[model samples]
Target: MTDKIVESEAPLTLVGGGWADRALLADLRRHAPGIVAADGGAGLVLASGEMPLAVIGDMDSLDDAARARIDPARLHRIAEQESTDFDKALRSVAAPLILGAGFMGARRDHELANFNALVRHPHRRCVLVGMDELVTLAPPDLTIDLHPGTRVSLFPMRALHGWSEGLHWPIDGLDFAPDARVGTSNVATGPVRLRFAAPGMLLILPRDALDPLVRTLLATPGAWPAP
Candidate 1:
């Protein structure tokens, strides 16, 4: 957005308009280091005394106060009303992995929209970081190291079948659908392995899995299967 293309090849942390506490902001900055705001999220970034690389959105919610604090060079206004601010930011940026915060704790509709945006941009890997949980699209093959008895939830945005290993309850042959069936509250017996039949399967794990999951996503090669 800022004529400034992100030259860094590292993953980026995208801050959204939800409930980003100072602690969460600090943690994201520590790991991803590069921050970008989606419209109203600029206020949160400005409050942290740090400027985002660019603010990409419709520019409807961006107030003058927040705008004044940011350098004009960093403001990017898409002006289209077709998509949510999260979608605008995701499409505008090019990064191998994206860690999003302040996107899950707000209104239910907003949270749902954010998830839809993630699935729409399957080529761009992302993990939605919340206070108590982490949500990410299940890659074709995912191996995660978790202690025994850890909670793992699988929510489907579309109908799909999958197979799993080292789980208290296997996901083999299960038809997962958003409106019909879903996998949730499954426990891990040991390290977990999953193979998805299709994209749109979201893996919800404990918040502690954030860093490890991001690492795994970045290490994986190729884009997700085309929708």
Candidate 2:
């Protein structure tokens, strides 16, 4: 088993080497004060004039200058080429919720991989913050209060079935699969409630919903067990 690099009771902010800005970082830190970096994400953390509690990655993208700035004890390198740095960092963290920035809005392929990592580690409740939206894996049962007409998109990583409330188009009998029917651009009629038969559904919401989503996930008792 991979040893945990960070164990936190409060939420953690995980920065990747993607398109993150100072405002995004500062906003995320407001909810999740503890910070960790994924590979070259150390550069972003340093640029923000703050140091991460730990940097977990393969060390390929992390530069020498950033390496020199960080304390040696905080750098935990895993010399394997199989997984992405996002995967490494996500798996190593034991937190109630992880707010990830700089993992989206850069490369499409990297953003896709980051989504893949979310489902891959269902036990880790993480929300990836983008410029305009936030994405997270739908827990076994989730309820969030959102305004009517809010956009709630659900993308499946694999085959699954689910039911919903407060969505304009319900997903009761729908068979969701990556290659089959996918839920996107769905509108909410009121407060939203979602229950998934499996652990592959990705919940996409507006960036403003991060706080309520985090609260819902933390309060919900139903979470996918580690596989």
The number of the candidate with the highest TM-score is: 2
Predictions in order: lDDT: 0.85, 0.94
TM-score of 2: 0.98
- lDDT per residue (tens digit) for residues 1-227 in model 2: 74899999999999999999889999999989999999999999999999999999999999999999999999999999888899999999999999999999999998999899999899889999999999999999999999999999999999999999999999999999999999999999999999998899999999999888888888988689997
Model 2 lDDT at residue 181: 97
Runs of candidate 1 with Cα error greater than 4 angstroms are: 1-7, 225-227
Estimate TM-scores for all models: 0.94, 0.98
lDDT tens per residue, model 1, 1-227: 45433535888889988978778988876668899999999999889888999998888888999999889889888988888898888878877788898898888898999899888987778888889899888888888888899999999998899999999999998898999989999999988999987789889999888777777787776568545
Cα error, candidate 1, residue 35 (Å): 0.5
Record all residue pairs in model 1 with backbone atoms less than 3 Å apart, i.e. clashing. none
Return the top candidate by lDDT. Answer: 2
